[model samples]
Target chain A: MIKVQEEDFDVGQEIKNLTQENHAIGGVASFLGLVRDIASNEEISAMTLEHYPGMTEKMLAEIEAEANRRWELDASLIIHRYGRMEPGEQIVLVITCSKHRKAAFESCEFLMDYLKTKAPFWKLEETSEGGKWVDARDSDDTAASRWIET
Target chain B: MKILYFAWLRTTIGKSTEEITPPETVKTVSDLLDWMPSLGENYSSALEKRDLLRIAINQEYADPEHVIKPDDEVALFPPVTGG
Candidate 1:
């Protein structure tokens, strides 16, 4: 599953739904990324993330498909929230289920690395100082590159 | 011809995408960037880092020397940052 929207999601509820149909699954790995409260030391009020409408969905689906191809995952879920969102909001969620713990763990991490580097999302944070655009970090690219060595 | 600006490039351009007929000799992303004088100073300034900008032809990422066809879609975006 791939979703990009403005609404919040329930992490526990989503995890349950993703793993419910497969009773044979022995492991599930999940990740939740919350919007940070700090923006240049100013209190962050909200953030509005803009994405290439059709392209964002397409790119994420391709990334997920790649992950599935590389690992033995039975199912995967990716949810990303866009638009103006306040602090404490859930910005992203990832879930992976497999027959074993290694598959679940590795797939979840692999998907996250791809999402961090390949997903097309522009993040803008609204802080007490004003709205500021975010930049792509070299560390993120490095994180993704690490997986290539495996 | 279609042109797409993504991520910070879109912010600098103040628009997402635009359609226009290419001028004579417009064949590469570099050529298009050189001729985008009407997109505003910020666009010209933000696009300074040609090496860092990952471009695409249609839906696939392309090289700087990639040939652009009349009906092709071109996208310009920085390295993606998300988790």
Candidate 2:
């Protein structure tokens, strides 16, 4: 499942909904991203997330499909939020379920790594000085590169 | 065709979307990039550094060599920073 929305989500409820009827699923791994109060020594008051509407969903679905192809996953969920959000607010979520812990854990990480680099969302931090767009980290590209088949 | 911009590109270009008809010589994504700057100063400034921009055709990532059709929807923006 995939969701791109501006509204906040309930993590526990989402997990329950995803794993509700899955008896074969023995393990579940999830990650949640939150807005931070600081960036580059500056105090951030809010963050405005921007994204290409149609492309965001398309790329997310493609990422999810790749994960399913690479692992023996039973279910997965990706929920990414856009628009303005305050510090400490949840920004994204990734959950992967499988019959074993290894697949669940690894796929969960893969989902997040790919999403960070491939998804179309961007973040702009609002500070005392002014609003600044967050730069794409080289480390994120490196992290996503690790998943590429050599 | 419809052209879209996002993030700083949108802010810099001063518009979210626009419609344009390019010449026949603009056959690929790279060609389109080269032609866009002629639109105005904002287009030139926003797209001055081609490497910093990413492109998508009809909502899917497109290579610079990707062929473009007259009806295609092309989008340009910066690298993603989402999880």
Q: After superposition, how far is residue B27 of candidate 2 from its true place, in Å?
A: 1.0
Model 2 interface CAPRI class = high
What is the lDDT of every predicted structure here? 0.82, 0.95
Q: Provide the lowest-lDDT 10-residue window in model 2 chain A.
A: A16-25
Q: For residue B22, what is the lDDT in candidate 1?
A: 68
- Compute the lDDT of residue A17 as modeled in candidate 1: 91
Writing each residue's lDDT as its tens digit, candidate 1 over A1-150 gives 998887889988988897788888889999898888885577777888777677778888998998888888888999987787778888899999999999889988888888888887778888766677788888787888988844
Write down the RMSD of all candidates, one decimal each: 2.0, 0.8
Query: Which residue pairs collide in model 1, if any?
Result: none
Off by over 4 Å in 2: none
User: How would you encode candidate 1's per-residue C-alpha lDDT over B1-83 as one tens digit per residue?
Assistant: 88888767877778888887768787877787777765669777767886788877877767777888889988888876556
lDDT of 2 by residue, A42-123 (tens): 9999999999898999999999999999999999999999999999999999999999999999999999999999999999
